[model samples]
Target: MVRMAVHQSRGRTQIKDSRRGCPRYQPHKGKSLTFGIRPEHVTEKRVHTASSQVDFSADVQVVEPMGMDTMVFFSVKGTDICARSAPQAVVGAGHRMEFTVDLHHMHLIDPEKNRVIGHRSDDKAKTSD
Candidate 1:
């Protein structure tokens, strides 16, 4: 697991399996990196009870209802983020709504290098004694 602070945000969010595959790019403590998660991963529904899942509230900026699903837009630490939700589960714009982000599906990118530095892994890490 890895903990990173979102830019302009007060606290750090924990991400699981962040450095599973990429061994060459070692992110130094306090170094800035990009956090990315698919819109589907950020949802109003809580599917997993894993430790990697985090719950937070954000003010909804816009709501686009697309028949079966809705696209919710909000801002986090000055960055605009979107969430895909069931059409019936979405609240109106300008309202505070709760969201669950599955950090296991998160991707960490090295902004300077424009490369993915870390991500979740489905397989166990191999250890050499």
Candidate 2:
């Protein structure tokens, strides 16, 4: 269990996510996103505890699922990416995975809203009159 400490001028407050514990992600397979290969440059890094460190690239795409509990997708490149079963899998900052495409030339889509962010270079252009 994780405990967060909140301090007030008068006193202190301790907040716990759970007293005993709670299950991780529930079992439900409804919708999932399929990511492709993309390139990105290494941007930042973070040190965890005193031993481990995470490296992050400038072009990595971090995706948070709609309503699910503990499901997140990290897109390193167009075709290369990793899925985390638990949130604790990805720790620190600066370093995530690796990508082959630049940060500016990346595309992402939110199917639920029918919204697309970014685009592929080879995609057909839409001309406006």
Candidate 3:
């Protein structure tokens, strides 16, 4: 779902899933565009068994412990994204760490219309209704 151009400033874009190849986000009829990954899906472990994976290294900016999940803030691709970590993630501000993106959880969007391009069958079913 994440249709990105892999820049050098950040990292390369790896498309592992694409089992459905690439689908259109109706009314646009174009390729996948912007995408978003929820913090909850961001994990310290790179899920090699997952459908796809995206990796990057960023400097930790903040760490907010919230009982079960710790909120981590870091900058990547000139944007700051949060990640949900365990109670003891052994991460702290000013540290550079590599993070992995779970491809199955990517929320892609249509560039022209800034609309989410649903890639799941459930999405298609809901939209059809």
Candidate 4:
């Protein structure tokens, strides 16, 4: 498992990943890699609480209400991030709201290679194939 310090608007949140032990990531361990998570994976409501789920709060910079879901815009460490949330759960811009990021769905990219190194779900799919 690897622990990453994510700098947020208010403070820093440590994200823990249980999949770091995967052999595929061993060589890249301790090297710089880009972290990514889909907007859908970052939600206002978490399906379950796991060690890989990180909770943090951010000020809403923009809110787009779609028919089925709402897209929320925020920033962390100067990087703009979007999160998909249930329309009813979305708060207006300028308001602080909490979000949970499911790291199990996160993707790690090798910066130099400019491609995805691996992710928890990807490893599972590859093994099954």
Question: Across residues 33-56, which tens digit of lDDT does each residue of candidate 2 receive?
Answer: 222323222122323332112334
| Stretches of candidate 4 exceeding 4 Å from the true structure | 1-21, 47-49, 119-129
- Give each model's whole-structure lDDT: 0.69, 0.30, 0.64, 0.73
Q: Is candidate 1 or candidate 3 better by lDDT?
A: 1
Worst 10 residues of 2 by lDDT: 20-29
Q: Report the number of the highest-TM-score candidate.
A: 4
Candidate 4 matches the true fold with a TM-score of 0.72
1 or 4, greater by TM-score: 4
What's model 2's lDDT at 10? 23
Q: Is candidate 1 or candidate 2 better by lDDT?
A: 1
How should the candidates be ordered by TM-score, best one leading?
A: 4, 1, 3, 2
Deviation in angstroms for 26 in model 3? 12
Task: Please give me the total number of clashing residue pairs in predicted model 1.
Answer: 0
Q: Write the per-residue lDDT of candidate 1 for residues 14-119, one digit (tens) a residue.
A: 3333323333234333567767789988999576688677788799999998888899999975778899998877899999999988776777776777666543
Model 4 lDDT per residue over 9-108, tens place = 2232223433333445556656766778899999995656776777788999999998999999999767789999998888899999999988778776
Off by over 4 Å in 1: 1-26, 45-47, 119-129
Q: How does model 1 fare in lDDT?
A: 0.69
Which model is ahead, 1 or 2, in terms of TM-score? Answer: 1
